[model samples]
Target: MRLAIFLLIFCIFEYALTVDQTNFKTCDQSSFCRRCRKVKPDNPKFALVPGTLNIYSDSITADLIHKDNKHLFSLKLEALEQSNTFRLLVDEKTPLKPRYKVQDALKSAPKPGSIKVHEGDTEFTITSGPNKAVVTADPFRVDFYQNDILTVSVNAKGLMTFEHLRPKPQQPADGENAENPAANDVKEADEIDDPGAWEENFKSHHDSKPYGPEAIALDFSFPEAEVLFGIPEHADSFALKSTSGTDPYRLYNVDVFEYIIDSKMALYGSVPVIYGHGGGTIVPKKERIRRAATLMKNDPYTLVVCLNSAGKAEGTIYLDDEKSYNYRKGEYNYINMKFENNVLDVNFIGKPNFKTAAWIERVVIAGLGRIPKSATLIIDGASQELEILPHGEGVAVRKPGISVQQIYNIRLNF
Candidate 1:
């Protein structure tokens, strides 16, 4: 009994040590996360076929069903605005439910741009501006080209899998009216409580996954880039390392107990972002808009940030009329932005999930409904160079110490 009490005291001691919320999760706290860290290389599934395509005003999305239907997998391709960055998303279409998108890092919803897609002998030509873009797609491989130079390739190694969400049926093949009433009830109960899919209770924490198995995994290779960076919220160094024999970068956002230093684990905020570094890489900071001394940084050279909304990004991107976000227009200012004019505001990026995010916002507000609005929101705008004074509850979530979030402090300059 002494040992159990000692362990409990240790956990509490560790939890009290962290502030500023930088370190989110240690590698050990997460279950599937720890499992993914120890993956092997022998087989990666690369299934691609000419599935279907949908065209909208600004963005165009295409579905890629795996050649091996054994795994119900689908990949989405999107042409976004500004630099016409092509975004590819891979996930299980009919997962138990849906996946959550954490693409709030993008300052605005990128506009849909045009791509000159032409059929080639083996591959295809997809160019937007002056660059000669190429896409070589087959059943098990995908290669991207820029100016005849192969840049990024997906599924090159082939170990991409989307753990499909399935209902726990006592027997999948059980008839609608099974002979045994007891057996049917048990099957129904199991589906309601599929431990493998949703409702994961870990370490005195109950994570109610309204949407079931929506895990996304794929291998992207940057043949030219030797160094990579940009997946903040971890205590690790700026530069990333090989998770080959280790863990794939964790993306789930959770309130970790006592996150470790220099390890791959989910944190308070997640930006599913990465960039090539070293040769021609900038200091990662951009010029400040109002000259508060903190300039936004420069974006990474190459990246693959995934955005899977509540159920899907389906029909969501099209809902926006003029909802294309470039660099400097939104709720969250882009730290490292590529903009012509200097404009900083708090906003969101990617396509339309405003409604979906609204639902999330409502849930958040409802759960913390007891907290007054005056106390809940920190009213601070960087453009005006002003801050809000927290009533009596004290600084909520942030401290206004030489940072932009000081806007929450209502201290007007007289």
Candidate 2:
């Protein structure tokens, strides 16, 4: 019947294509997010150039002047000694050219820790091992810390903007002279009053920005974080709400189609990775029941875990290889979980390739609130004593030989 009415009109045009928040964009339609949310923490035209700070051995550069067009801009602050992770980077210390960076989105190039620089006068601190960052200078900020506890702050709310790169304004000949001298030297090299910095139209579609307003805004906060989750490919709601009167979580990577769930829009995959949980004090149930599970060798991987209401938990493990990036060269496989005083350790290193395939066939272990009539499994060191299952609020420790060399030592004694 004409191929069943062309498969029923392609399933009614793929269920009528959803998600169209007016085709995405707000922050007053993004002229550099409306000049970085109208930058004002008493913005006396920004600062931070006193002595231009340096401190290297893995990053911390400076120079950010713009006291009304003194214009200098460039601030970096790396520190990722094997993933403790912190990277700030503002741009344009010198640029009439080179800008656009988002390249390959990092999977390497970070390892460089052991820092310790203190300077102090208007702010400068960098410590490393229990983390610390500081770096203030009048209106420019940076914060971040861990053992001193304040975790992440960047541009505190002055909304660090950086739209520099100009030249494109000459149009004055019909008897020429509105102020023409190549349009007043491109209006004195575009001094930002920003009429969308030379062309933008949106729905009727225009955009001609042509490398004129480089656009880069900042604002990370987190402070004492009472829950904030990853900026995933949003259909929204794995708990991340509160943008204080809407729209501030957009990560940009679109292709909406059926998206309209809680909606911060921008869907179809964009992992900017945010995660912050109820902050400070209370991570000493011997470091909250020590856990270090690392099972990587990707395959439909996703492990979220954000239990707060004070059971204090934090988790994020997303392996990949949906078809191959070959886990980027190391190939991959390793899981190490350690539970402490009540004992429950696991360790499954790699490379025994029995033709690969079997990155953990089964292992459940949910919250475990109670219901421990009995449980003890220790493969590779041999010992088995299982039988416990209520599996609702918690309690379901199933297990079945996780692959590669394998060595588990589970022991839940409740």
The per-model lDDT (C-alpha) reads 0.44, 0.62
Give one digit per residue, the lDDT tens place, for model 2 in 1-414: 999999999988876764556777798887877766666664545678888788887677888886666779887787877535567777778888887677777766667776778888889888777778888888777788765657678777776667677676666667777655554453343377867867788888888876666776666788666777778577667778887656688777775456776667767777878766653321111112224433323222211222233333332222233456776665554444444443455554444222344344323343444466676777767888776566555554553344433556657667
As a TM-score, model 2 comes out at 0.33
Candidate with maximal lDDT: 2
Question: What is the C-alpha lDDT profile of model 1 across 293-331, one tens digit per residue?
Answer: 322222111111111111110001111213345223332
In the predicted model 2, the residue pairs found to clash are none
User: Which number leads on TM-score?
Assistant: 1
lDDT of 2 at 293: 30
RMSDs, each prediction? 17.7, 17.9
Error of 2 at 239 (Å): 11
Error of 1 at 149 (Å): 3.7
Deviation of model 2 at 107, angstroms: 40
